[model samples]
Target chain A: MARRSSLASRIFPFVFGLVVGAGVLYFFLPGPPQGGKVQTAQQPGAKPQPGQQGPAQPAGSTLAEVRARGYIQCGVSTGLPGFSNPDDKGNWTGIDVDFCRAVAAAVFGDASKVKYRPLNAKDRFTALQSGEVDLLSRNTTWTMSRDTSLGFDFAGVIYYDGQGFLVKKASGITSAAQLNGATICTQTGTTTELNLADYFRGQNMSYKVLPFEKNEEALSAYDNGRCDAYTTDASGLHAQRLILKTPDDHIVLPEVISKEPLGPLVRQGDPQWEDIVRWTLFALIDAEELGVTSANVDQQMTSASPEVRRLLGTEGKFGEPLGLSNGWAADALRAVGNYGEMFERNVGTKTPLGIPRGLNALWRNGGVMYAPPIR
Target chain B: MRWSWTDPRMRALVWQVAALAATLVTLWYFAAMAHQNLARQHIATGFGFLDNTAGFGVVQTLIPYSEESSYGRAFLVGLCNTLLVAALGTVFAVMLGFVVGVARLSTNWLIARLATVYVETLRNIPLLLQLFFWYFAILQPLPGPRDSLTLLPGIFLSNRGIVMPAVETTPSTAAFVLCLLTAIAAAIFIGRWAKARKLRTGESFPTLIVNAVIIIGLPGLVWLIASAAFALAPPVMGKFNFEGGWRVLPEFLALLLGLTLYTAAFIAEIVRAGIQSVGRGQTEAAHALGLSSGQTLRLVTVPQALRVIVPPLTSQILNLIKNSSLAVAIGYPDLVSVFAGTVLNQTGQAIEVIAITMAVYLIISLAISFAMNLYNARVAIVGR
Candidate 1:
């Protein structure tokens, strides 16, 4: 009886300590996102329908979370020249990078308060959906499936692009129709692969595809004579050509296979965050249409035009409802300049890419880049 | 029926049941949390995406596949490619490992030292770097199709791949195949019968030469009977690449070469240790009985060494199969690169896709372990 009492006394503290430790650890462990609410069914469309407002009070507000964590995390491409390539000093420079800065400028009033997460084609969507990035400003195509099924919202089109083929000049393949029984190299997990297949099937031609995980590998395969041609977005072709061994030896065929309305996106549950990203993009476009340049934004603030006054936040309280200061558009414009300025600075004719603003030009200038008026 | 705290048996049972309950609760919590999070995120989660069109092309496929094929078919194609590389790598590694392991124990100092050097040099380097070295440094610099090096009349080596003549089958090809199968079966039967006769009569037959003759001679005789049973279709140079022939891709060759060489080095070490584990007295006993050196090894050392060799050898093979997932780095289109990668990205079904991929690898590894364990039992020390 004494030995039994001693054994019980020995194990009682150990058992009690284990229960106490487990209770403490359970509280310390990070829980899931709070407040489970049913998600409103959204229509799967690239273009946002007019008069469709985001939820007034989100279950878990992304804006409040962003405010708690100071800087917005932006997901960009690993490296695409005029889109989101990092320079030698590791400072990212591209139109996509500038758009990220514009969003940061609007929210925090500081352009440099944003961090970049460079992602590949396969991991871009996963990274955004998992809340690793606040916005995906990468050159992602705005498609129906991505908008609805993937649980994302496309803010607006940043670049009106299309797929094209890049082939060596020595091969003398002048047109895409001539690429029969040819082996083409492209990046996997991208729309380019599907477009190539559809184009070939429609033309009643045959070809083989060598899909690599990254664009650099695909380009390397094409350069090593493993593939007859390379295919990607036409803007991407122009940008990637400059990094080739002999840029002058290749030519992009004059055929646009599919429409690629590249844009920035955010996750769908947080409607307020989506509205903020959408309005920031619209502000840049509206600023360009209203002749509000970054250098002259302060001077144009006092102009007589009500549209410019409203956009510059001089005549309205449009920014407050989206959870920002009244002068949010002014701050965004001051950081990245207008849309035209961004286009010309990164991939315009002056740059090595030398891409002309063809379909990306304003609607009044023989292009279809119109934005909804900020009423 | 009150529980007694001091009763040893009852206490042990209670603790075991409590631990099991804790583990079950933890696992259930994680699963429930994952499902809840997925639902709240509004991300589509299901295996229905397998029926959707893959809409992508793979460079090399063992089965018939096109862009119009479903994602499930693409997964099958990737799986076949992976299995092909793993099987070929295993066969070549085992053969080369045995040779090198035996050579390391050679009487000549030069051969032994050379074998040691080969093992040390290969096993020390990372497998991925070796893959890159074989792929980019060695193969990529080869001449293009226009300037291909003609190895023979119809074989060409280029950066694209190795282009060789393909055998075009004729009407008598099936007869030729049947003859080959019959010879193989006859050889096996003859081998067993010779073993029985040797035990019964105390005299050995020339089983090796006779079995060899049956296997090779029968195939040769059938070919001679049907002279035009097959024709060679040589590759013709086209505008961009060679057309209409068998082309072995450089990516596949690089992966196979890297896997075989790296694994063979480890396998060599295992084999050397296994052989040395056999007592030296056993060899001396066979020698005292006037048995030849070759016969001593075949009759005594190998059977004993196999018991020690198989368990570790199974590990190295499983490592090789898992290492094939690195095919994505060089565009080899293995299962991970195609299904887990491209399919996951397109469908945005991360939970389902990753779970499926992990389950497949688990099944493959378990199957290998089960088979190897059975073989290990067969070679195990059986005592009364």
Candidate 2:
């Protein structure tokens, strides 16, 4: 009798626990699992629930969510001087920051209604996919894998860039060909690392690479002579050189390597949100081609040209299809102006970066930056 | 049958069952929720990504690797780097810890005070700051490759790394190594035979000198015979940097130095407490028997102190290994930096990468714990 009681005591809790656990799980179960196409976030303001059934469509869920939250969540670089950097007064400035402000103006009609989440190169894409940010305006390269398999959509190219090298002037190395058997430092988890590998292989030269997780670390290593050269985008090399200890000592090599079309990105499964971001970039370029500046935007609203009139939302109601007011383009233009004004204010020849508008210029002006018409 | 309501045994059983059921339900609900969320994101969940090509380069690799290698190869390289630092750090920390700990209880006042200062300063400051100081402040200020600090005819030190001469092996190099191993085995056998003989009889032999002569003489004779074919390859300064030699990276040196110094501080305290646990009577008794201070420590006190020291020392070694993940901050390419940071970013498979990384650390820690526990059992007191 004693042995039987002891055996029961040893096994009773586990058996009882299993039965109770099953009952609790049954009570909390969602509806029956479906085996057809997976449901996407298409219904505006609909929270994610299991067993949801609907055809995947762009129902403006992201826009409705942003409206309910009263602000746009934007992901930018940690601190790239001319791209997306914070000033001494905690106010963000540069081309990427101004682009987010333009989006906020189009959505809420208030350019100040935006919050910035500073992310590193490694964490930028994940932050956008996880719904931590509505738009990632950091200088991210658009690749096929990221746009499809990684579940993201590239809006449009904001900067036409290419990989370049920065070497010290005293080294007397004038060209990229002289960098054979050199030790190069670059930021990790970036296209710059892969491109460095590809370029060296194509040249059939031996070199070593040191990949740091941040830009400043890589630059510091190069400055301290731990590396013979530093590599990144051509514009990045120019902007980062200003912060080095001896900016005049280093010179950017003339050879351009892989093409890097840097742009903003959003998560997949939301066509409406993707269209809004894509056309916002188009509106900036279109406004520039039509001779409309932020200062003259109010006057352009009454312009005689049909193209300018359509873009300023006077001749057509194009904003309604994107779930915004008819004055959306005018508000966006008033907040950050045209693409040319943005480039000149942040990184053009007049600014510290002094990068020329070579490939980023409009197609009609012998550059490849062309946007579809508003009509 | 009827049950008694006021029986203490029955009341305790009812409470236990209820608590068990509640805990199980909570765990089940969380696992279900995670499953649902992952399915909704449509992110692939599995270890299949390990076979894909890793298209990036690592600063240092222990084995053969390239951009065309698989992600699995990258993970192994990271693991090797981590193990190298952790193993070397543990050996150096224990040696330093014992020396400082013994100095703390010394008869000299200045030595004891300096030892006290070292322990207090290191243990109070954070390990991450010390790593940054070692990497950026001290090492980064060194000269470039053009003007390297020449330590010897064949060795150079600079901000890039420490370049040293490497041995160019000949056909007879394997024969020389075999002779060396034979000498080591002979020395161990002779030492054991000498001890057994001393126990049987009351006479001692010159065992130390004999073993030293055999170990050195046998390897020296073999090397002399192969000198005609052997060569030493010294580093040559190239236009960019040093060429054709073995180099030790500054990142590895800084991380090893920081980890050893920080862990040795805590270990010094544990050793001090252990030595103090041995009673003063043991030393006094050894002195009355005409044992010197050195003999008293090695022969009488340390064996007893080992009973207390081994357990806490095990935990300190474990802490050092886990702390090596901070190598990412200094760019050492340890398991966390290359696998969890870079591979996770490239593959975007957070769940699998994180799970595998955690399992690796856990397994390493468990293996260390198992070995230490066995050692602890052997040294433990045997009650009558």
- Local accuracy of candidate 1 as per-residue lDDT tens digits, B131-159: 98998888878999989999888899998
The digit string of per-residue lDDT tens for model 2 on A221-242 reads: 8898889999999999999999
Q: Which candidate should be chosen as best, given lDDT against the real structure?
A: 1
Clashing pairs in 2: none
* RMSD, one per candidate, in order: 7.0, 5.5
Give the alpha carbon lDDT tens digit for every residue of A18-114 in model 1: 5533432332234332333333344644333323323432533677777789989999999999999998989998999999999999999899999
Q: List the residue pairs that clash in candidate 1.
A: none
List the candidate 2 regions with Cα displacement exceeding 4 Å. Answer: A1-58, B1-32, B226-230
Listed in order, the DockQ scores are: 0.29, 0.30
Superposed Cα deviation of residue B5, candidate 1 (Å): 8.4
Q: Please give the lDDT score for candidate 1.
A: 0.86
